[model samples]
Target chain A: MDLLYQIFVDPFVQMGTAPDLLVQTLWEGLVSGVLYALIALGFVLIFKASGVFNFAQGIMVVFAALTLVGLYEKGVPAFLALALTIVVMLGLAVLVERLMLRPLVNQPDIVLFMATFGLTYVLIGLGEIIFGGDPKVMIADQLYLPRGAIDVNMLGGFVSLQKIDIAAAIIASLMVAGLAVVFQKTRIGRALRAVADSHKAALSVGISLEQIWVVVWFAAGIVALATGIMWGARSNVSFALEIVSLKALPVLILGGLTSIPGAIVGGIIIGVGEKLGEFYWGPLLGSGIESWLAYVIALIFLLFRPQGLFGERIIERI
Target chain B: MRMKQLALGVALAGIMAAPALAQNSIFVPLLTYRTGPFSNSGIPIANGMHDYLAMLNERDGGIGGVKLAIEECETGYKNEKGVECYEALKSKKPVVVNPYSTGITLALIPKASVDHIPILSMAYGLSASAQGQDFPWIFNPPATYWDGLSMIIKYIADKEGGLANLKGKTIGYIYFDGGYGLEPIPLLDQLAKDYGFTVKKYPVPPADMQNQSGLWLNVRRDRPAWMIMWGWGAMNPTAVQEAAKINYPMDHMIGVWWSGSEDDARPAGAGGKGYLSLNFNSVGANYPAIQDIQKYVIDKGNSQTAKDKVGDNFYNRGVMNSVIIAEAIRNAQQLTGKKEVNAEDLRRGFETLKITPERWKELGLEGFAGPVNVTCTDHNGHHAAYVQQWDGTKWVKVSDWITPMKDKVQPLLDAAAQDYVTKNQPWPKRTEACDKSS
Candidate 1:
């Protein structure tokens, strides 16, 4: 009886008594969800265009962020550093297309996936050699990112929201809206969707697979830069940020690997679910449940819809 | 036939390299992690250790006329790679091995007795390994996690007016949930019971170290009067940032020594001011020994240490570690009456090692660390540690060396050591005995 009441009655009662804290928790959940969504968006862009799981997306986030900061530290102007970082990302996309994806174009999906694994190590080694393995402060101040928190009185208490978190949510929404426009209205968007449907048919229709690959990879690189900046603003920019990229996998599973909107919705679900689970139900299970709760939520969702919520249905003619 | 010829050639090369290894030097292999997720802290510590040994080789011609041959085998702070490095370097006949991470230290504890090599974890391994009877081959000198925890509790008690004032007050503990981070739980639990205080535990998994809004939100909900952290690497800075976000008083929050580096607080800028962390070694390059290290190692461009990180907390802590090891070598040489010493001789050296004030002055590290004295029964020297406050730019010492509650901590250590021995049956028994001097 005591266990039952503690499970069902206590958390709700606590929420009622301290609505301000509840608001704070929900806001935090939303902010983290948006960041996770951004990372998932990177994975979705590449997967949608090329059917290859880019394992290096996480390291690319770190590498892009590190390059921006490292260049700024070397006396380059902040905006120039930003522009140079974009050029570097473009070069990276071209290099990946020419060296890795081009040779393995006709191979099995697993081969391309394994190739990204090699890319992950190469980037790690190169990043360390160049950046010297030290955590650097993100150029948030130079980039005009906000700081401090805003406290508002509500529900007979105060709720604090970080200014940077608010900015992140806003910037992420804008980026997502921009990507949606590019995918739906642009000529490259048609070719991308056509290739995503069937590579042979798209090629027969005069869409160059190589050109589409480079564009999608460059788009993913931009998403990675946005993610690195937002997340690094919250924490220090270091190799440890790579691990947080794994959080996007569950988001990918929940949102559908090929659906951009699915990535956002899936990210919010995992992020909010993880926070609420850890805050209310985590004590019952000895805490640290946040580490695996997102995966479990994604797994349950997969059980109901094997193709994911926004993913296209698979209809085989065999 | 060609493959066999190649194999024969490799065997001949291996045989020829054996005699060259036994020439005139003492080999000490350092299993370090200078590149990885933990490299933010690992690089400085590795640089300190490397620079100190190099200083010895350059200035004094090594300990007692034997050149110190220091080799580094990078483990990248992974347990599997640590074990691999151990196996790879064990054939080199190193006098002692310093497994930097607690996971690697635990892995090597059982192997050390069989291999007849001593393991020196310095301030960060299993708290129960301090019991010399059960863990005869492993040494965590200067202090243990239990010691560090007791000191923090004592300091908090003193600040709160009295130990009785802690009753009914909730103290929160946020830890990394790994072997090293979870080490102080039993001691903290025992202390809470004795003091009548309530303890709330918040664990941060390694995967979620950078994403700890959930933990801090819980912190806000619980509203504990004081919070202590057992975090490392990237977790340190993130936790500090979250605490600042929730407007937690930086003075009321404290971190363990591993979480006290400049890297931990520099990211937060001024918001991290007044944050407290317990430290065993002094920070700064004002010491004569550090000056020698700069002149001999860095100036010559023979060191991998960054010029700016010469006197950082973790770097200085690394130098302190080498000081203990080098002094032990000197002690062993004096006792054995030989220029070169073996692993068993190093063990005896550790048992009888003493870092008195006079010795510190002689070694040119007069005020760098607390005096350490190791006995046969106590692998941990039970030395006191000081609390330092982050003053925005650097850490400044704010308190004297505060000793742990030995009376309260010893029984727990003994019981834990016994429990470990009972669990790992057929554990080796200690055959050597010495006088108690603490």
Candidate 2:
């Protein structure tokens, strides 16, 4: 009975008693949700265009960040390095189209997935060779991203909000809005949606699959760069950042793999849900459940709604 | 017939070349990880370990007239890979094996006696292995994790006035969720019980090292008076940054030796000031030995180390690791009177090894680290460690060397050792005789 009370009754009581702590946990969860959604956005863009799960998305984040920092360390101005990094990502998108996708075109989805595995290794080796294995501080000051925090006193206590986190939330929202407009209102967006619907059908209608693939990959590259900067500012820029990208897997599953908006909602749900679970209910299980709690939530969502919240349902007659 | 003859001829040639190469050199295999998530920390230590031995080979013509044949096998900091490296290198008859990881050391402990190789975990391994009587083949010099934990507790107690003053205070411990983090928990819990303090744990899984905001939120809620961190690699900076973000007092947070590095602190920027961590070796390139390393290794372009990172904390720690191995080799040569020492001879040398303050100066490493003396009954010296505070830019020594409470630690260590032997029944008793001088 006491265990039950501690399990169910205690967490809500604690939440009710300390509204400040609740707000802080929710804020952290929301910021983390935005980052996870950014990574999931990258996955969604590529998956929508190519129908291939890019296993290399995680390493792409590390590579993009390393390029930015490595170039800056080599005496390139910060803004110039950022521009060059974007150009490099474009070059990478072209290279992937020419080398990996074109060669293995029309193959099984698993084959393209395996190719991405190879791509992950290649990028890891290249990044290490070029940037070395040391962890580097992000150029947050040079980028003019805000630092420190703003503490709001409320409910007889204070909730501290990091300024950089606020910037991340703002930037993530703007990017999502811009991408939504692009996907809905532009000719290129129409081409991308048509390609996502059917490659052979889009080709029959005179759409260039190759061009669509490059554009989507380059867009994903931009998202990865944004993510790398935000995450790097939070921690250090290292290959270790690649592991955090795995958190997006749950977000992708929770948000439909192909729905951009679904990615955002799923990211927040997983992020907030994970933080609240670990904070209020973690001591019951000895803590450290944040790592797997997101996946567990995703699994539960999968059982309930096979197609994610914002995903379009497909119906086929047998 | 021709193919068979060719294969036989090549095999015979290889057999002839093996002994010829072994006659004039000593092989020391290093288990390293240079391409994993942990590689950020591993790379510097690998470079330092390699550079120090390479310097010896270049400057002094190797230890005791025998060229030191050092080979590194990448383990990626995984235990299974570490065991595979051990299996692959055991055929080369290495004098010693430095696993560089606690999980790998735990996996190799049982196989050490059967394989006739001494495992040098070097301050990071099974803390009970410090009991030399129960485990003769494993040596962890300088200090064990439990010893380091005890010293950290003592430091905190001193700050709070006394151990008795810690009665109502709650101490938070954030640690990596692995053998290296868990090894000191028994002692920490015992100390907490003795002092009437509550211990709240926050374990960081390897994958969640960077995603620690939620954990820090809990820290804010619990409001522990002090936070002790036993973290490594990316976990250190992330924890520090999150603590700073939550406005946790930086001075009240302390990290273990593994968590203290330029790579760890520099990433947190100015927010990381006053964060204290324990370290055994002195930092910087000012010592004569480190200067020699720069002169012979880095300046000559023979090392992978960056020019500016020559005397960083982790690099110096790696140099200290090699210094122990080199000293043991010299001691073994003197005792056995052999130019090429085998694994067993090196084991005896490790058992009787001693590095006095005078010897440290003689080795051109004056005041670089504490004096280490390994005896027959005690493998780890359990030496004192000092606290270094990160002052936003660099580490500054903040306190005198604080020794472990042996009276408290010894009983737990002995019981742990005995429990280990009972669990792994048929464990071999110590049969190797100690050196007379030891």
TM-score of chain B taken alone, candidate 2: 0.96
Fnat across every predicted model, in order: 0.78, 0.81
Question: Which parts of model 1 have CA positions greater than 4 angstroms off?
Answer: B1-18, B432-438
Q: Where does candidate 2 clash, by residue pair?
A: none
Please identify model 2 stretches exceeding 4 Å from their true place: A312-318, B1-19
Can you tell me the DockQ of model 1?
A: 0.82
Candidate 1, residue A33: lDDT: 93
DockQ value of candidate 2 = 0.80
Enumerate clash totals for all models, in the order shown.
0, 0
| lDDT of each residue in A1-318, candidate 1, tens digit only | 988987898888978998998888788889999999999999999999999999999999999999999999999999999999999999999999999999997999999999999999999999999987888899998999999889999998999989999999999999999999999999989889999889999999899999999999999999999999999999899999999999999999988999999999998999888988888878878777888999999999999998887988889998
lDDT of 2 by residue, B152-271 (tens): 888899999989999989999999999888989999899989999999999999999999998888898889999999997889989999999988999999999999998888877888
Give TM-score values for chain A, per-prediction: 0.98, 0.98
DockQ class, candidate 1: high
